[model samples]
Structure formats: C-alpha cells, structure tokens
Target: MVEAKTHLATKPRWLTPVLFSTTIFLSASLLFFVQPLFTKIVLPHVGGAPAVWTTAMLFFQTVLIGGYLYAHLITRYLSVRAQIALHLTLWALALFFLPLAVSAGWSYDAEQSTAGQTLLLFAAGVGLPFAVLSANAPLIQTWYARTGGYSADDPYFLYGASNLGSLIALLGFPLVAEPLFGATQIGWGWTVGFWALGALLLASGLMARGRHVRTVAQTQTQSAPSLKTRLLWALIAFVPSSMMLAVTTKLTTDIGSVPLIWVIPLALFLLTFVMVFTNRPVASMATLRLGYLIGLGVLAVVFSNLLGIHVSVWSAVLTVVAFFLTALYAHALLYSERPSAEHLTTFYVTMSVGGAFGGFFNSIIAPSLFNELHEGAITVAVAAILLLIRAVRPSRTALFGALALVVVILAKTTLISTFGIFVFGAIAIVLFLAVATTIRHTEHALAWVIVGFLVAGQVFVNHGTPLLRDRSFFGTHKIVEQDGLRIYGNGTTTHGAQRIVDLTADRPEPQLYYHRNGPMAQVLTSAKADASGTVGIVGLGIGALACYGQPHQDWHFYEIDALVSDIAHDPSHFTFMSRCAPDAPTHLGDARMVLAEQDGLSFDILVIDAYSSDSVPVHLTTVEAFEIYLEHLNDDGVLVFHISNRYYDISRPLGRLAETLGLEARIQDYTGNTAADPGDVGSRVVVLSRHSEGLGDLNADPRWTPLASDGGRVWTDDFANVLEVLNR
Candidate 1:
C-alpha cells in the first residue's frame, strides 16, 4: 500500500479532478440538452400545451431516479473492474438508440391520456441514452471517491462542475444551439459528444482501478446514516424540484411554450445546485435565510395581485427571481445536510427519489386534485414550513399581533372597495412590516405569518368563485359570470363571453375576439360569398365562431381540448354551438394532426385561431404546417391567422412564411374602443392567399395593408427562435 501510494503521488496533481470533472460535465450537458430538444420535437404532436413540458419533466425525473439507483447498486455490490465493464457496456448499448429522433411508428392518440402518451414517446425515443448519461454524475463521483487521491476524501465538489455543465447546456440551447442547428444536426452532434464521453469514462475508470479495493474497506468502516437523515435529504430536495416545474408552467402558460421559456427556470435550478455544492458558497446562511423570506413575500404579493400590477414582463421577472432565491436557499440547506463521501451514491439516490416525487406530484397529482394552478402557492407554503423548522420560537406579542392583522385583512371586504385598492395595499404592507420587524430574530414567526398570508390570499384574492371550473392535461378552464356576461377563461386569457340576457335570444352575437367589429368578424365577412362552401376553424372556444357560420355553409371545428368542446356544446354554459351550428362536427385532437388525417378534404376558407391562453402554438405557424394548410385550401380560398399576442410579434414570422412561399399576404391591426363594447378589444389578424384576386373586394379596403416581413425568419418544424421576435 505504501509503494502504491508513492507511485500514485508521482503523477500530476490536477489530472484526476480534471479527468473526472470533464467526464461528468459532458454527461450532464448531454443529459440536460436532450431534455428540451427532444421535448421540442414531440411538442407539436402533443398539441403544444404547456403541460407537455411538465409531463416530460416527470418522465425525465423518474428516469433519473433509476439512474441514481443503478449507480448506488453497482458501486456497493460490484468490484471496480466489474462496474466499469458493466457501465461501458450500457453506454455502448445506448449508442444504437442515439442520434435521437421520434420513431416513425409513434403518433399521438386521443383515446389515451396525453401524459401517458408523452411518457411513452420519451421512453421510446431518448430513454436509454438519457438513463445511461444520468448515471455518469454519481457513478463518476463514486469512482473519484475511491481513487485514493488527495481530494478523494471529499468528492462532492465535482457535483458543482457537473451542474455547471448542465447550466451551460440549458443556456446555450435557446441562445446558440436552437438558432444555429436543426434537430438532425443537434442529434448528430450529441451522438459525437456521447462518443467523446465514453472515451473519457474509460480513461477515468482505469485511473481509479488500483485503489478501489483499499477504499472499499475504508468506506466500510464509516458509520451508515439514519433513516431520518435520508428522509431529510429527500424533503429538502423536493421543494425546489417541484418549484422549478411550477414556475415553468406559470411562465409558459402566458408566454409561448417554446424552448426558451422552458430552459430559463431549469437553468436557474441547476445554477443553484452549482452555487451551493461548492466549497465556498456565494451567499452565507444568514443572507440566504433573509433573501428567501423576502422572496416569499414578493411571490405572495404577486400571486395575490394585491397591488394590481399587470405588467407581464415585470411580473415574470419577479416570479423567476423569487424562484431563484427560494431554490438557492433550499439547496444550500440540502448541501449542509449531505452525508460523507463514503455514502455519496446513497445520498444522490435519495435526492433523486425526492425529485421524482416532486415531478410526480406536480404533473400527475396536482392537476387532478386542484381546480386552479395552486401548485405554486402550495409549494411555497411547504418550503417555508420546512426551511424554518429550526427557528427559535416567537414572543407572544408578535404572534398575537400577526393573527390580529390576518383577521383584519380577511374581514376587509367592503373596507377595500370603499377606501380603494391602493390604500388597502399600502395599509396591508405597513401591517406586515410592523409584525415582521417585531419577530426579526425568530424566523418561525415570520414563516407562520407568510403562511397565513398565502392561505388568506389564496382564499380571498386573485380568483373568483367561477360558475364552473375544469382542469385537464391541457390547462385550467373557468366559466365565470361577471359584469352581466358569462365568460370562458383559460389560464389568464379570456376565450369567449356572452351577455347573460342573450341566452334566450336566437343567434346571439359572438363576443370577445369574435365580436362584430373585431378582425375575426371582418375575415368571416370577406368570405361571405363562399359561405355555401366548406369552412374549417381550428380552435373551438365556446364555439364563438360558430355563430358567424352561414346556414348553408359546411362548418367544421377542430379543438385539442375535449373539456373546451364539452363547455362549448353545453347550452347552460354557452349556447353558440347549439343555436348557431348545432350540427357542426368538432374534432378532439391537435389541429395539425387531425388535419393531416383528412385525405380528400378541402375548405373554401380556413381559420387558424388555436391558442393556449395568449400563446399561439408554434407548430401551427411552421413552414411545414402552412404547407398542410395550403394543401387543404381551394385556389381562391384564404387562410386567416389570429396572431394577437401580448408578448410576441407572431405576425412577422407569418409574413416571412408568406414571402418564402411567394403567397399574397395582408394584415389588419384592429383596435376598437372597449368602452363602447367590452368584448371589442384589439386584435391583429393576418390573411394569406395564393393569388391577389383571392382576397375579394375587402382586400381593396384601407383597413387591410400588406404584411411587413422585415427581420423575420421563416420558421420550420426543424428550427424556430422565439427570442428574435419578442415584442421589445
């Protein structure tokens, strides 16, 4: 042993850490990069709902648990040589399944659960390679722990390097890889990266071979951890894992469900891991606790809408920052509780189990149990309780004061309306600060107050008692009755509305985006001459567009969510479909997929208005998608795109598509005075045709103008960058 140590000491100092770090880094980079890439590939088929990403996250987390388990079992039971041979064989087997692409046989099935379908698709496409890659972080770290090097006693720092690689990959995907490379190119590059990782793994294994026997004996001498400690590890890991998905879903629900939105929260999550796992953390524990409390307060205010701040961009930034602070603090606590290097693989296994449970809860359990998007609020409450468990007890005065404030705020119903919202907001802020200052030294008191605020906010603020609330794999839908109108809402966007007094009237007027003076009505008017022919509409929001259909027209509706279809057909909730076009057929699946199945069908006019909240589905706007639309249109038929959005300039990309196909395109940006009719809000619509004469007489009207295609990139299914077209 002395001679072996002498021989090992003769080698260079930095080689082992660098070798293991590089191997672990490459593995982590590939692991994270493939998540968004593969999910993006399968997104269009799944209807482009934000829930798709959440479901995909559940699948990946479950697979990560398997990978961590594999690492623990192999490192504990097998000899170093056996472990190396086994892992390498697994890598080699995974290669045959690489250069990842969805199989030709796979397609979305409406009969089955969408989440189940998404899981199966991921399992078939990238499961093997991802599982193999996931093992490298823990597996390589275990090898490093046994290498008998100077730093072998504590190998956790390498985890920082691993997460750094993950952060880089996530950040690089939207900014660099996604813009410059297609899916095929990314797949091939990833395959080459896999080859490189394999070589590095082999080199790393050989270096650790000689010392493993001795280190195994040494590790056996150390005391194993208690069950309580293992459970603690899991609970600490669960909060941030669940919070990451919650924040992602919140952002993507309103913003576009593109790779950029998905990557931001995940990148921040990994960055926290990188920050906390280092020998010297970026923030001290004192600083972390304070920041975390501040973050919770900010999030509570935002979620409750206490101040009525409606700027989407600022709201998004604040939520993201709050998430970052909470995750950073949670991970720092997790790091502080980590076990010794001897039990490192076991530690990681428990953490992965926790992460898997978090994903399972958010993706599967929450959607079934809750009517609203309450996961974010619930996670925050849980995090505060767990994180402040060690805080000192508060004084009786402070506790009583907090309770008194909570009671007063909950009972301030008419007081708020009488004094105005801003005055109420100011008074609430002052009361919270006074109580928080009294219990400055006792974090537990602060936590309880925050929890009370969250409970009160969830119960009294932000949302109303809807006439009906429904949730599914797509999103949350609420039918609300307010201002003497029955409104259908999905996420933050209003889908359709109708006056309650009009329920008994025949052919009730369409409201919201389909109002009489809105762009949708103008498009339908332009195609009035072709009313006797077939008309196909993509989105079936309360079947509002059904009222615009003429009696002799063959009207067909395509809607992805079955819940929306049910709501639209229910006369109790919405009478548009029953009264206007009672016989119109509604297809229950993704618009593009169902349209592709229509072999000999063609429409005289096609309207594409599919949106999840204010977000337009990217798949519907891609070049390949337009080709399908064109194929289904008559020579003189027009394609109408409802491009109204608060965050993105979608019309630019559509214009670029028109220019690429040499098709005539015109746009209408209609802004009606809402004071005249609340439903007559602003809308941006673009119309495309194969010829100039196809636009009809209204094409000569001054309300419509040629589309501006400047600085726009024609998006294809293989490539799109939403970052470029953001509304500055």
Candidate 2:
C-alpha cells in the first residue's frame, strides 16, 4: 500500500496539458467562427462582392499583428502573474462589445472606398474580441513553455492544437453551424463560447500560479534571434498568407461567394499549420517535385485558359490542390526554421507581421496596381520562383544550357498563340531544368528564368488587348472585340455583347442572354402591348435590355459597381447602353438596398439580371428580398430572374421561394445558334407574377414550363445554404 501510494503521487497530472490545450482550442474556435459569421452579415451591405472577403482578411491579419505584438511585449517584459492579469483584464473588457453585430447606421456608399469602409465596420463590430482571441495561441503556448510540464520545453505542438481548433471551427461553421443556425444565433453562441474560454484561461493561470514566473537574469542569458533569421521567418510566412487570399478570390469569383467556398481555402490553410506544427510527416522531396509539376499545370490552365477550363469542378479542385501543396511547403519551411521556446512570442510576432503585409499587398496594393485580377497568377509565379530558389542548384555549364534552351523556346514561341501547346511545353522545360539542375547554388538564375517565362506567357497568350480593362470593389471588368462582336466580360463569364456591325443601326439588337430570340426578349415582347409603365433592371450589364424599352416607357438601371456603370456609359467600349438607353438613370448600390429605399416607385416589369460571372449574390434571391421586390411591383407586375449559370441550379430555390409566396411562375430555357451568331448564346429565365394573366402568352407557351420547387429549402436573409443548389 505504501509503494502504490508513492507511485501514484509521482505520476504526472494529465490535467495541465489538457487544460491549456482546451483553452487554446476554445479561443481559436471563437476567433475563426466569428470571421465567416460577421463577414456573412456584412456581405449584403457591401453588394455581396467577393472582394469583401479579401478586405476582411486584411483587417483580420492586421489585428492579428496587433495581438501578437501585445503577446510578445508582455511575455518579454512582464512577470507571469502580470501577463495573466493583463490578459484576463482584456478578456473581461472584450465582453462589453459582445453579441457581435454590425452597426445599424453603417451602409456602403459607391463613391467611398470599399476596403476602408469594410475595415471600419469590422473594427467597430468584432475587432477587440478578435484581437483578444488572437493573442491566446502565442500567449498560452508561452505560458505552457514556462510551466515545465510535459512537452513544455517544446511548446510549439500547442500551436497544432490551436490550429486544429481553428480548422474545426472553420469547417464546422459552413457545414454545421451556418446551415443550422442563423447569423444572430451564431453570434450569441460565440459569445457564450468566449465566456467559457475565459473561465478556462483563469483556471490555466491559477494552475500555473508562481510556477511560470521567469527571472530577469534567466531571460538575459537566453540568446535572441538575429535580424536575418527574423526576416526569413516573415518571408516564409508571407508566401502562404498571400497565396491563401489570392486563391480564395479566384474560387469565390468563379463559384458563388458563399461561406462554403470561403471556408475551404482557409480550412486548408489552418490544416497545413496543424500538420507542420504537430510533427506530422511532411511531403518528401519527390512529392514536392510532383507538386511543382502540378503547380505548372495550374499555371498553364490559368494563364492560357487551356482546354477552356474555366470555373468547373475539376478546375477548382486542381487550384485547391496547388494551393494546399504550396502552403504546406512554405509552412514546413517555417516550422523547420522555428526559434526555441524562449523566443516564441518574438517568432510569432514576426510571422504575424509577414501575414499582415501579405494581406495588405493582396487587398490594397494588387488591386490598385493591376487592371485585371492578376494577383492569383502573380502569387502563383512568386510561389514557383520561391520553390525553384529553394530546390534548384546548377553548374555553370547547366546554367548556360538552360539559358540557351530558353532562347530557343522564346524564338519558337514568339507567336505564342499559333504554337498552341508549345507555350506550355516551353514553360515545363524551363521549370524542369530549374528542378533537375545540380550544383552548389543557382537560385537567382532559376528565378529570373521562371519570371522571364511567366512574363512572356502573360504578354503573348492574349490574342488581342482589351479596349478597356477596369477593376472595382465588385470585380474586374473587361471589354474586348471578338468574332465581329464587342463583349463585356466579368471574370470568366460574359456579361453582355453587341454586334460591331450594328453600330450604324438606330437601336442595336440586345445580345448574349438578351438576344431577341431568348427568354428575355420573349418576356419583354409579350408584355410590351400593355407595359407602358416603369421598367426597372437590377443589373446594368452594358444595359443590354435597354433596347426593349418603348418611348412611352421609363427605364431605370440598378448597378452595384460604379466601374461597370462607367464602362456601360462609355460608347467606345460598347454602344448598347449609350445608343439604347442614353437617358435612363442608373442607381449605384446593391439592388436589394436601393430597391427597398425607392419610396413609392413601382415597375410594370422588374428584371433581376445581376448575376456576375457564375457567382450568385444570395441576398437578392432570399424570401425577404422577394417581398421587397413585391412591394415595388404593380399588383399584376411581372418579375423576371435571369438564372443563366454554369455552376449552380438556383432555379429550384427561386421556385421554392415562389411557392412559399404563392406566386405563379414559368421558366424558359432558350437555346440559340451561337455557332452562327456569337451574340445569340443560350439563356434560362424564370418569370413570376402574383396572377397567371400577368405572364401573358408565356403562361400558355409550350416552351415555358411551370417552375418546379422540388422541395428545396427556402433561402432567407437570415439563412442560406449554397451547397443545396450547387450543380453537381
């Protein structure tokens, strides 16, 4: 009995490590959960632009730097008890701003900068709480390091636990929390979680009472990291941070800007941290080489639009894979270069600084500097260069041979469009040479070669320059003349097109989805006889529907992006808006908000044609938004939704909303001969009204079928699940 009691007393208490881990986990969960929840709440206010997420990422990163700075300072200078007191005080103070919500008075203005406005809103809403939560990972890990408990000497593993919590929260919000709870409910739930985390923190501090206090003499004896090491840490961190945001923009711009898409990239990012910091087996050199090859393939697809692979499931998967590999590689390097636990806070502070700079570059610098959405491609190029720099070493003879081969390929692909696959072949050869070369070091030569190839590909891949390439808070817009037609493009999708030959015509024909043979024309033509009242359009895509207006009717356009509005008004780009509806007034703001504010204005025909690329602004399709539309429509007014998309089957959800509202609806899937006239592409439109007579001939036409609900969930402003309507 004496021997057993002694063994039991000597046995380590398991509670300390578990206690600290749990505290870090809960704090991380709260931090990530609020990101999507609050961003989703702010999305509609900012026109539901995907850039809103990019801007929010910037804000979060900047605040994370602040949090890490605080941690670094307190851990370096203060006593353990002092640090605990200060942090606990901060936790308590953050509670005053809880039950996270945006201010009711705030609203986005088109004339104001979007990034600035979004930053201000986030700062006002959840900034303090997020900062407090951000500090926990580094702070708790430092405390654990000083506790002299299990694995305390190497406390970086605790970082893995923090990221594991982050991963769970990010994935759960989209897959579970968001689907199950509304925004308000999620906010309140997060507040409760925050309180629980505080209690755990207090308990953790009490457990480590007097045990974690460090002597000034002990601190002075520890060596600090050199400037070069600190800079390397920041650079290694910056690559993945920038790449994450860039890939997110690419995904959200192509697919719908929903929480599911938002979470996938971020989850993968956190997963990388979890893997690297937990001492999980990383990819081998051979595996990394394979990843480089895949990265090149991704570049081939992105730069050249190879195989017409724009916005498809496989394309998205490939992009995500490339991103994952790049982030894993960069973060593994970061882990390999980690400082000892004594300098933990300083290490994290540098990492946060790098991440903040990356966010700033992607969110602020890139957009302002480049005319197109080139940040993704640019980051990919940088990643390629960095990987090559790390992996490549060449002899003088090999370097000379590579330079000679590049010259030959450049000559052969001077007319790149004609060479077809040769361009990608050249890119592959250059990258392969960079990888296969062996010597002491030739990273600079390899980097320059990669950059040269990328620049050449970027310059030569485009067959012709755009007439106008403009970017706004909403997205990138391009006007190009192709196939005897002038086209307006947003991302990978064509917004509108007009026949160049029809420039002399008094009223040029509407093209693309608005072609005379399409459902848009059919509906307008059918309603023309009695529809002399106001005509309201939600999207001003080159104002293609403007020609449908009669002299007796009044036309108004609601366009969210001011840049798009400016382009539509410029006759040099497209003559559709200038010639068709030169006098029509265009409202600049989100369609839902603007429409709700239109006091007594009613429309005989209301067209919601605002979908850009394949991205759906979910807020506009909700039941509440439909009610708002109904408020602005005449008793028998017809409502039209342009549902043409390559990635989503949203008609079912709209049909569900129509069923819930007890409205009559019909859909027309119009197929046109684009082979003969590029402007006459296919279109799908859904028309709804309070009465069947409002649909006129469309109700009886065989081409127009009754819209099917198929029992999908009715989306509301409070809740929406994009996964439900995703096209398989």
Q: Which lDDT values do the candidates have, in the order given?
A: 0.82, 0.79
Best by lDDT: 1
**Candidate 2, TM-score vs. the true structure?**
0.92
Error of 2 at 327 (Å): 0.9
RMSD (Å) per prediction: 3.9, 4.5
lDDT of 2 by residue, 1-728 (tens): 56544543463668778999999999898889889999998887876778888899999999999999998899778877888899999999999988887788887786788789889999998888999999988989888776556877678999989999999999999999877878888888888999899889888776655433333345443589999889878877887788888878877888978888988989999998998786664665445444443454454345444323255676577667767876776776778778778788899999999988889988999889987767766766666566444433334544455445433443453423346457657666765576456444455545555566656666665557888887877888888888888888887788888889877778899888999889898888875425547999999988888888888888899998888889889887777778878999999988898888779899989999999788877989889899999999888889999999888987988899989999998898888897877778898999999989877777888999999688967888778888778787
Q: Which stretches of candidate 1 lie over 4 Å from their true place?
A: 211-214, 305-311, 391-444, 462-464, 527-532
Local lDDT at 575 for model 1: 95
Q: lDDT tens string, model 1, 418-504?
A: 333543455456545766676554556466656676666555555667899889899989888988789998877888899898898
**lDDT, candidate 1, residue 181?**
82
* Clashing pairs in model 1, backbone N/Cα/C closer than 3 A: none
TM-score of each: 0.93, 0.92
- lDDT against true structure, model 2: 0.79
